[model samples]
Target: MIPVVPLDRSREAALRALVDGKAKPLGALGRIEDLAVRLALISGREDPSFDKALLLVFAGDHGLNQAGVSAYPSAVTTAMVATLLAGRASANAFARVVGAEVRVVDAGVAADLAPHPALVDAKVRRGTRNAASQPALTPDEVQSALARGAAVARRAVEAEGFDILAVGEMGIGNSASAALILHRLAPAPLADCIGLGAGHDAEGLARKHAVLAQAAARSDASDPPGVLAEFGGLEIIAMAGAILGAAAARTPVLVDGFIASTAALAAIRLEPAAADYCIFAHRSAEKGHALVLEAAGAEPLVDLSMRLGEGTGALLALPMVRAAAALLSEVASLDDVLAGRL
Candidate 1:
């Protein structure tokens, strides 16, 4: 695991004091106050600005889809990537409202996506092998995927001047893989981590149990990277690395629900320092999400029963994040009131 450059704590006490100095009564903003503090710490400044935002939808395929784990077909991943590229997905709608740029990544789609300006071709492979009986990706492929993921964030933040990043995935059946990954990383029981991913029915859930049970038994991922390489979808690995990259750049990273949280957990497991950069965007309708959120100690910014996995939750939360940053950077301080400033 690469060592993460830790968030600077020079302004830790001053930052909180400054947040309290806002014109409102202390703690009046609730979680919005927490969001402001977090954004401040990530940027390591008393004032943090988030006028630039990005939504990266990492698309991949899950070999678990070969089994009946999800209601949607595996082909839906590619089609949805196309939908995202066309700016017709739910995430795009939210991005439009929030004024965030949306970029689709071919992290590991089984099919070659047609060339599009909005798509960043960072595919590590066609898809991962079914973890039920085999490792998802070879160690080399996993390393490559992780590197690619980190590169995307680094490029955006360093070269393109991206301020905040929200990571989402478009892998059909990835929730099962996320469950498996969470089961290995967190102390929760395997059954506690399993959920009805992408609208599974009774038979589909039964199949999920049978196959994921086999995956748990077959996977021996003792460490964070091992867990990711052995059981994670390519996009999941990439998202984890992206979180790491954001932390390295000292930029806030919005973690979406369920599968995205699974990646956040992986990133934190890899380097605990990354947690400071993460702002969980929402809670998902999928079962076991609360448990994962608890394990990560994340209080989501919102909960809309949203289970759509395309950075939609993060997009919906973007405006709120921007507002928090705006308050930190532009809002009046108690000093202004003392000076009789309007």
Candidate 2:
């Protein structure tokens, strides 16, 4: 097990000095400056750089889709996973543009995909059981999913030597599951966070809300592990573990869309220090996402009205992170300026 690192005062002081030296008035960059400082602290480097980036897309299926929560069929999860591995998914295109390696992990898709060289067969199960009808996953399944996610993070950090990790998910009806988890974990109402997931109409949205409400009522928020066991999808639980593992490894984690944010929330609850390593990649257009971000006090890097959950938003924001790092590492300091340095 990778040990978690607590944020140290020395690291914080170095971050402050670096940010204050940026080519702007102190604190003028606002949250962007804060973001750079946070990245520095998490990586334990006075100057942080995401020269090598890895985006892990964990695919699964939510049994809750049987309740009409999503317009797309559950098979779409497997299909998208295949598409991603084929380098044809939107996430692949975005990652290509940003020069980041994308890896697709089969967390728990319902479909039986034959051995494909492109796919990382980290299957925890065929898929989660219906949460609206029963528990989404068994305790063993949840534990296995988390362990798989952590293993993936370990490989990314130890083998690939990635400086930044982005989290993404593909699961039908997962938005509903995330909403339920958010409702239970956050001090927010279910209705406020529920949204028209995957282009659901009024009736579909109504049904999604109802299913989440039922799951929320039955959940025991006091026991987060139990809540996750009872209502969380494999992808969400896996993501929670990834966040914790990434933090333990002291790598900067870029949280993707709504589902990814909810997973981060779960990991944050488990270890509050984990938040120090997380970067809210974007403010998802999903109705519940904004509330989740607010509840966690996360200021996202982008607000392009993105609803995509395949780490596309996180990839889009990577350039900004790279730029921040470059400024810190390459830009001249105030001492250089005062000494008439060229």
Candidate 3:
């Protein structure tokens, strides 16, 4: 069965009526009003809760990182995952601010991460091979990564009962991979998909563009899996699977920045119905992210010039998701308003 069920539009009127009947005037809750209706429709429950949310950071290295496209070294991917595990990373700080537990998955980091409570050791391989010169992974390897990602989402929802999810990626050159995916899936121009990731210089940006164009020209993804295996990092693949898994369980998801949005695109490509389960958290300062967000049919909650991954963007938006639910359940109805029960 497809993971995401088609949203039941039959109930739209009743749901919106409920939102409109809230104590405040119509649209007073603004986007949260829309958020409330959408969540109710997606979950098939008028009074759903955003009480629990899970954050997944899928970390990996990219062969394309060796091509000098990113300003950060590939080693930063593994190092940052270490910081995530230590709970001292920026993601953790925001996670605390937003109320969530963090889980780091070693999707395919080049370095070996020691066992940690917060880490899911689901490494597909050391890292992806250089896509500029070769295929990123075997088709079989791609499926493995996808399954690992889906399994994590399942555990979060089924075992832990998380009602919402956020998927993020950590990979140095994955931005190039994301661009390639958006170029293929979004079918945007190579230039439109290209961006100055991690602040590349003029020469670096030019070289980055040249390499991504070459990679795009050389590779073609025939299907969702093909698109992912051809250009996506392990972390990206896992994130896509997590999205699909969450959608399958009727759990809402907050998509993070460029790479995470690309993963969400892949998930939707695999199953278009998954889009109903996603909420874009924020726009990234990184280039090409807007195009990807457009392709995903998402309007982010904020634009804070945030480009850091590790699920921070979505975590920052967690309150909005929760607030929508809170308002829906806590506020008095218009009937109560008319009855002078406020």
Instruction: RMSD for all candidates, in order, please.
Output: 1.3, 1.8, 1.3
lDDT of 3 by residue, 254-325 (tens): 999998999998888888999998899999998899998888888998999999887889999999888888
Query: TM-score for each prediction?
Result: 0.97, 0.95, 0.97
Better of 2 and 3 by TM-score: 3
Per model, state how many residue pairs clash: 0, 0, 1
lDDT of 1 at 269: 87
Candidate 2 — which residues are off by over 4 angstroms?
A: 1-3
Tens-place lDDT per residue, model 2, 181-281, is 88878857889878877788888777777877777776555566877888868888888888888888888888998999999988887778888888888
| Candidate 2 local Cα displacement, residue 63, angstroms | 1.0
lDDT of each: 0.87, 0.83, 0.87
TM-score of 3: 0.97
Candidate 1, residue 214: Cα displacement in angstroms equals 1.2
